[model samples]
Structure formats: C-alpha cells, structure tokens
Target: MRHDHHGRTHRLELDDQTLREWDCTVVASDPEDGLVLDRSAFYPGGGGQPPDQGVLIWGGVQTRIVGVRPRDDLWLVPDPDDPLPPAGTVVRGAVDDDRRSLLMRTHSGLHVLCGVMARDFGVPVTGGNMEPGVARLDFDLAEVPAGFKDDLTAALNTEVTADRAIQVRVLPRAEAYALGPIVKTATDLLPPDLEDIRLVDVVGLDLQADGGTHVASTKQIGRIEVAKVENKGRGFRRIRLRIAD
Candidate 1:
C-alpha cells in the first residue's frame, strides 16, 4: 500500500486536506465492522488528533459515519440505526466541514505554540491532545517564568498574524533525521520500522515530524487564547489553548 493508503482504501485527505466530499465505491460492509470504501477523504485518527465524522449517501439512503476504525481496512463506523450500504454500492462520502476545518486550525495553532516554546523557552513538548477548537500541550519546563501565560498568548497570536505558510512533505527516514531534531517532542515516539517521515513546517518558524491535518497558513488559525496553565508534575507544564474567530 502507498503512504496515502490504509488497507484497500485510498486516503484522499493525506494529499488534500481541503477535500470534504468525494465519490467512492463500497468495497466491504459489515453490521459490526463497519463500511470500507475504495476511496475516502475521512481522516483516520492519529498523532493525538481524533478521527473524522461524516456520512455516506447512496441510493437516497444515508449512513451517518460517527467514527473511523483503522483496522486492516479503514472502517467507517456508521450510526447503528442507519441503514448500511451493501458491498459494491457507490456512495458519496462527506466529512463534517465544521469539525474538520476547526481541527485543522487548532492543529496548526499547536505547532506554532510548540515552535514558540522551543525557540523562546528552550523546552521540548512532552505530550499533547486536541479537539476541534481546543487543545493542550505539555512541555518539559522545570519552572514557569513570571507572566508566562500572558507572554505565550501574545507571542502565539503574533505568529498567527505573521501569516506564515504551512507546508507538508514526506521524506525518507534517514533524510529527515539528517535535518536534526525534527521530533520537537521530548521523546522519539516514531516507530523504528517506519521508513518514511511526514513533516509539517511552519515556514520560517518550526519544522517537525507530524501526521495531522493543518490549515494552509498561520492566519487561518484566527486568534489563539491561553485558557489555562497547569503543573502536572515536576518538569511538566501543561498549557491549554482555545481558538476563536
């Protein structure tokens, strides 16, 4: 399978994040295992980002896809009450635009935060998680500087206003590692057997190995608010962020 494939399904979202709706054929369907499509734009969750939610329409019938399971094939879990499309059925799949778009902004915003923290504070990210418009990233900071939250919030929005272009690329493992410290996270969590690395670059700001969707530029992230800062443990500072119009 290709880098853009999950089993038999060709993952369209990996190459085109803006794709919301696409026509595909049903390769397999099971009441419990869910539906598998020959081509899909639904993003199967990974790298701390959740899977996409959407619907499959065929023959005037609709199957609400509530979640995606990355099994041997990309399984789209449908609403239990909705009728399942049988195998060989041709359907139009649509990802929830509001949810996916917001998530893209939120994910890009986090990368900005990571870049700022690394450049200004000299700390690496410890962990993180995100939803549509809200997220939290943990940092390996031994001490919180005075006025850290306010300073960080101001710096983040400044970068967003800078309107830096966000670029994504796939590089061979050795070539990517040669760039040095591409994993801005505290730990090297990438699988050893992985032969290729997907990288997200915030133009002149940050470049790191990532596998989540993102907006085209920083300005698309809108405004960023530092909602809260917490100390989970020694050297663990968690910063929560909220994205607003």
Candidate 2:
C-alpha cells in the first residue's frame, strides 16, 4: 500500500496536515463497521496519537464521526445516534480543527523531546503515548541526572524557540534505514515487507521514520513543561510533558 493510502481510502492527512475539510463519496457503510469514504482526511489512530473526531454532512444532515478504524479498509465510526451516509452518497467531511491542531502541536512536541534526549543524553525511545496537549515518552535510561526535570523543560523550550522546520518525506525502506544512526534509534519494529517509510524530520535536530501528523515548525508547539518523570523498573524512565500556548 502507498504511504498516502489506507486500503481503499486516500489518506489526505498524510500529504496535507493542514487540510481540515474536503468532499468525497461514501464507498461503503454499515451500522456496526461505519462508513468508508473514497477520500478522507480523518487521521486513524497511530503512533501514540489518537484518531480524529469530525462530522460528515450531506443533504442537510450530519453524521458525527467519533473515531476511525483501519482494518482491510479505513472505517469511520459515527456516533451511534447519528445517521450514516449510505454508499455512493456524496458528503463534505470536516475534521475538528481544534482537536487536530492541538494534536499536531503535542505530537511535534514529543519529537522535540526525542531530539533533545538523543542530542544531549544519548537515549533511545523505548515507548511513548500522547493526547492533545499532554504526552509521555519512555527512555532506556538507567539513571536520571540531578535536576533532570527542570533541565529538560528548559532544553525543550529552547528548541521550540529555535523554531526548527519540520518536514515530512516518504523514502524507500533501505534509504530510511540509512539514517538510523542519525536518528539514534533502530527501526526494527517495521515489517520486512513494507517497501516505503514515511519520515518526520526536525531539521538540524532529529529524524525518524514516523506516520503521525506534526506541526510545521517547532515554535508552533509553544511552551513545553516537563510535568513528571517516573521510574518503571530497571532501565525505564518515563518523562511526561505538558504543552501550552
């Protein structure tokens, strides 16, 4: 499958993260599985980010999309009480801008955290999770330096002030792997059969193979606070972050 496609649905978010509204036709619809559109900007949940919430409008009616699932094809889950647009029905889809925009900032903030950790402490991301304005990333570090939280918060905001450009690109799997050392992490989780990898590059800081949406620049992520750091057994240190304007 192409990087811009999830089964039969054209993933517009992958190409245009700023695209909030678009028109498309429903390819299929089921009460349980939800609707499938030929073209969609709804970002199905992945890589620590949740799916988008939005609505589909057609013929003076609205179907509120509460979630999205990617199976054999992308499935748009609508509110149970709302009506589902039938197959072949043309509709205008609009992603909730506030939610998606905050998510982009929060996701990009996580990348800044990753970049700072790799550049300053030489740590690798073992795991992570995020919501609209809060996120946490687990690192393979056995010890936390004294004053780590405050220092990290300062470092994070410093990079955000630098306003580094965030660029997205799709590359052949082999080529994406070539930048692994620069990324300071291994792409071992990727399937062997996958031919292309989508990359998010925080210019002059970090680069990694990723499929999540992100802000166009670091400054757009605004201020970041290191909320907390938790120890979860032998070599796992989880750092929590809170994003703000």
Candidate 3:
C-alpha cells in the first residue's frame, strides 16, 4: 500500500531515448520497501511496451531493479532482499541498452506496419503489443488481401530501406483529435482530463497518439520478417513480426 504523492516523476526517456544512464535524487522510499525517484528513464510498461529492466548504483552498492509500476507516480521495485535507499540519496540509474534498443526498433517497426496497412489496404489497428525483439498487431479486416503476407513483408522492408525519420511531439488534445483518420483509436479512448497528447509520427507514413518509446528512424529497424498472420475472428486479423539480425 503506497500513498499518492503530489509530485510527478519526470520521465527522462521520453525526450531522449538514447540516454542509458542518469543520476537522480531519491524522492521517496522505505528501507526494505518500495522506491520512487525524482526522475526516471524506466518505461513503466504502458501502451504495449514492456517495462524497462536495469540496475541502480548508490554508495558503491548496486541493486538489481526487478520491476516498476505506475501509480500516481512511478514506483521503482527493487529486489526485496536488498535494502532500499532513503529519500535524498543520489543514485546512478542505467537502462539495459541492448534491451531498450531492441524494443525501440520493434515499436517503430509496428508503426511502419500500421502505415503500410492504412496506405495500401485502408485498415486500422485494433490492438498491439511488443517485447524486446518481437511484436504483434491486430488489424480490423474482414479478410486478408491476396498475397497479403508477402506483400506486407515487402512493404515493411521498403520503408526500412527508405530510412524514414520518425518524429515525436506533444500537441493539444483538440488539435490531435482534429487529425481525424490519422489517429488509430476512437476519441473517447483518450483520457478526458488529458489536455495534451504525445504523438509519434513515422514521417509521411503514419501518425497516432502514443506514449511508448521508439527509434529515431525507420532504418534502425533493419530487416523485418512477417513471422505469422492469423485470423483471430470475424473482422480481426493478427500479424506477428520479428527483427532479423
């Protein structure tokens, strides 16, 4: 049981995805209990992306960060057997760069898939999720197009070859809503109190309100393989993908 804090933890990763290490002040924590920081690079597992895993070093003691959850603020769950630091302690936090890079590539790759589907087939994404090197996206479609698998694979690779630049920005909710069809989800799905929305744009390909981290360019995704395509149900199709080394 943790109490809500009036302060919000600054999310450093949102602005700079390439940042792997940072020094932060401990805002709240309890010895042998939970932890919170003034700012964090951890992604707290939202919008289909998995939470970040890493380590925190303080006073020459390094503790493995097991899990993180988002409440009124981000909670840094460290190993229970290890003692937690108290407030005001300065610690150096480092994200698992290899894992985070893979996730960024995978996430941006999914957006590329969405772009291809919408541009060529006029389908919208229904749902999606991503891990370190793999991802799956659900699309609203009555039937798979002819040579769908091959065509999609080719299109995705084409985008990667094009090396499109990915852009991220924040816009007013109303302005974002005005984009209309570019937004993949219904307006009501956005939180009512959220006056501002974060948007991830795959250049001329796709635009959507999203909070997950992504790579700076589509080229970073490398070669993509359409691992599988399945019929979930009527009007629902699932596409599984992975990054080829």
Q: What is the number of backbone collisions in each predicted candidate, taken in the order shown?
A: 0, 0, 0
lDDT of 2 by residue, 193-214 (tens): 9899889999998898788899
List CA RMSD, all candidates: 0.8, 1.3, 3.2
**Residue pairs in collision within model 2:** none
Q: What is the lDDT of candidate 1?
A: 0.94
Q: Which candidate's lDDT is highest?
A: 1
When 1 and 3 are scored with TM-score, the better candidate is 1
Question: What would the per-residue lDDT of candidate 3 be over residues 128-160, giving only the tens digit for each residue?
Answer: 888888999998888887888998999999999
Please give the TM-score that candidate 3 achieves against the real structure: 0.93
Scored by Cα lDDT, where does model 3 land?
Answer: 0.84
Cα-based TM-score, every candidate:
0.98, 0.97, 0.93
For residue 17, give model 1's deviation from the true position in Å: 0.5
Q: What is the C-alpha lDDT of each candidate?
A: 0.94, 0.92, 0.84
- RMSD of candidate 2 to the truth, in angstroms, is 1.3
User: lDDT score, residue 143, model 1?
Assistant: 95
